[model samples]
Target chain A: MKWEYESPRKAYGETLVELGKEREDIVVLDADLSTSTKTAMFGKKFPERFFNLGLQEQNMMGIAAGLARSGKTVFTSSFAVFATGRAYDQVRQSIAYPRLNVKIVATHGGVTVGEDGASHQMIEDIGLMCGLPNFRVIVPVDSNEVRRVIRFVAYEYGPFYVRLTRPSLPNITSKDDEFIFGRGAVLKDGDDITLIATGIEVSYALLAAERLEKDGISAAVVNMSTIKPIDKDLIIKYARKTGAIVTAEDHNIYNGLGSRVAEVLVENYPVRMLRVGMPDKFGRSGKWNELLKYYEMDDAGIYNAAKKLLEVKK
Target chain B: MSDISPEKIRELKLIANKIRELTIKMVYAAQSGHPGGSLSAAEIFAVLYFHEMNVDPKNPEWEERDRFVLSKGHASPAYYAALALRGFFSEEELVSFRKLSSRLQGHPSLMVPGVDMCTGSLGQGLSAAIGMALAAKLDGKSYKVYALLGDGEIEEGNIWEAAMTAATRKLDNLIAIVDRNKIQLDDFTDKMVILDPLEEKWNAFGWRVLSINGHDVVQIIRALEVAKEVDGRPTVIIAHTVKGKGVSYMENTAKYHGKPPQDEEEYNKALKEIEEERREI
Candidate 1:
């Protein structure tokens, strides 16, 4: 399989710089973690438009909301944990309630923050941010998608939550491909089962599909990047077409991609679904690969869950 | 900044008294509202709505209009009362404060016309005000942004973060006023957390600091006028005030911070004081 090196965080940072040049209304804010979150690129290029609030996440969120109220398209960058949990109330009342045009671009999402431990790792951000009204939560599978979604969210005015990972991931989708913010992208075609995943898990879903293909199971792979909108029509169509489904994500099994897909299925399709994610537990300090293995968020785990669900169907 | 005349000052003082009376009546009707902070902030609220802010009650969302954020949002009674009195909404709506289906919540929300941002969480408003100021600079708009903070709420770290940003950004169009009533939810702010040397701290953070007796309408107006002329840095007016002004028994008392008038006798007494003040005017 061909793979390209692309950092989703860096891609986001670069895209923000481009957006800043094109639209004067676009301003970037970082909470003293710009170098880590990759928003330093935007800052270097547009010093006039960039603001560093120095590790004050709550204040940063409120400032972004205020900027939105003043008709400036604002993007605030911080760690996923701080962005979602630390300032949840600020995001809820100031930004979401007002339906402001602010974008929260959070990096180091999931256990992929590597040696930073559980304090920095955020597996629950998707759940927390998606629960908010008027908040569009997007977890891009690769760097190409991040670039696309930045532009998409800029054009679509409202509050948005973008989850980015630290480690470099495979660029499964090409730059030439057209990607929409709220719409899910289908990666592989199959009939027996549908494999739905988001963020870092999307690449894993593709690998699982490849493994399943060799095992003679024709599995369809869907990159469900936009968690909030969920592409309801696509979820319903695939769940009904395929009698079995498997969802993989670097998030909690509850209130994340799995829970949303289950919501769609239980209501309409009533199909058998298996959720492959971090079991109801927080991550511990370890290597990224070890953490992924421990949480059962890898290809083998996805393949095993798929087989288990197929067996249940039989 | 313009020079204030004695006549203008007298008119503002009358409006401030009217605002205090309306706030007391609204809180009494709601039966569960913050009256102390509301009463203390009445003068500043009146000055913003009646004289300072270029707001249109009919066009609440006018993009070019000046913005005012009640950073100390528990004092929303004063804001709601002032807005109603300013024709943003009907005075009848003031009776619905803190009710189940009322727009007048314990905290200020954007549901009310002329309310800029939904702020109740303390220390969050100044950051938003900075955003508005920065936006004005970016868009090349001349409209100014004003934010009011409670002395107690300044203890929250986010307010300092905003203060640093406002000063660093040199947001001259932004003016911040701290209602230094020296009292918070349960007790005096000195006992809670002494934010003394408050003016020096703001000045240290690169702001132009000014101190005024908040109840003195003329002094408050003069300070606000000076704040607009400062070109390079933000201005913070430390307005020292009594917690519960206008009410004889409630002044400087923490019990009245969150509690409304007890019975008809208290409400009548409060109204009588306001009537007497009006008669004096």
Candidate 2:
């Protein structure tokens, strides 16, 4: 199957412009990275609704909370590292604790931020956001999914953290794929083992499933977009059916997609699981694809992990 | 400036005294809370709630009502006293402060009526106020946002970031009153970290700076009135106050910043001091 590619940030920016046109209360805030985060697109169309907070992520998060309290649906953006790490306290206390209607649309998630390296790469944003109570964490697979997620979070009245990558992701889901909050999408169906993935790794999971199919193995692929409020029922259904699970993501395996899945599986149905992602270490300056390959988050890595997991199940 | 007559000043002073007495009682009952900053800002809170801010207790979430962010949220006892006196909640709720299931947490929570933002961490309220002010400007609302910051709390780098943003955005409808009480948790602010050039700093950041005795009801009212009159930029009134202003034993002492009255004797003495001050007013 042929695949298209689009930058998630670009889709997010374009979709925000549309959301702005539809809802007068939609407001955008960026911490001096409006252009990089693609929020500048919304700023261009509706300058009055956009706030350039100028390199102050901590203040930006607090301001976003205040705006939300004043009855405005606010969308704030910055690099994932700064948005979640630099201002974690503000996000937790002001936004999450209060359960404000604010959407933190962070870009440049994971090592795919490339060349900017360990300093800019945020491998633990999911873990940090998941720790906060009342925070909905989402990592769309591609540009098409990014558009839908943005629209969904805009209308939803609660605090959310949606991460986007810098590199253009291969289009996995079509435009018609409806995004349901707290639900996982079954991209492929099989009976042998389940491949659960999020963010850019969803496409790799699909490729791995196809490879496993050729090896006389049936693999199922589930796109777990919303990390928090995770789909427990779907996960249990797949665990009972597949008998084994393989979780993959561009983040560290400790507290990203893998940990979240493990948390669900441990309580409901214990199963043999393999998590394929960046090891417990920082990333270095390299090309985006190089970083993925080096970190063992590529399709080949997923296939190898799945192959090993199948052997464990047998 | 709005002319505050002598009679009005006397009424505001009594309100300030009530707030101080209640704040002392709340902290003493809880036996664990900040009383120094709370006592120091009683007059400012009294003036804002009674004279300056356009707020209605019956409608705490009124769309056009003015907003206040207590940045130095450890001073929540003072804030709660003012809110209760202004009829935001029953004055009886003051005793339940910092207790389990009490609406009055150790820090200010929006769960309490008339509290705009949840601010306990220092140096965050100013940014929230800037956000509210910005929202008002975008929606063409006439509501103003006021934030109160502690002298030591300004040491957080985030406050400067927010101050720079407020000035750059020209938030004319925003006013920040710094409770320059000279003492923090450990010692005087000057000994801990000098904030001597405070007024010059706000002026350099493009704010209309006003220096006033924070305990003076008439001066606080006048500064707030002046803050509203300033155009195209935010205003910051650096209010010089003594920590634990109403209690002679606690005054200018950092020991009472977070410590309650040591025992029944001290508590009684503190209450007597506050009552004597009220009688003088």
Worst 10 residues of 1 chain A by lDDT: A177-186
A167-199: candidate 2 lDDT, tens digit per residue: 998998889989999999999999999999999
Q: Give every collision pair in model 2.
A: none
Q: Best TM-score goes to which candidate?
A: 2
Backbone clashes in model 1, listed as residue pairs: none
Which residues of candidate 2, in runs, are more than 4 Å off? Answer: none
Model 1 residue B59 lDDT score: 98
Evaluated at residue B259, the lDDT of candidate 1 is 88
Model 2 chain A poorest 10 in a row by lDDT: A89-98
In order, candidate lDDTs are: 0.89, 0.93
Q: Global lDDT for candidate 2?
A: 0.93
Clashes of 2: 0
Which candidate ranks first by lDDT, i.e. highest?
Answer: 2
In DockQ, how does model 1 score against the reference complex?
0.75
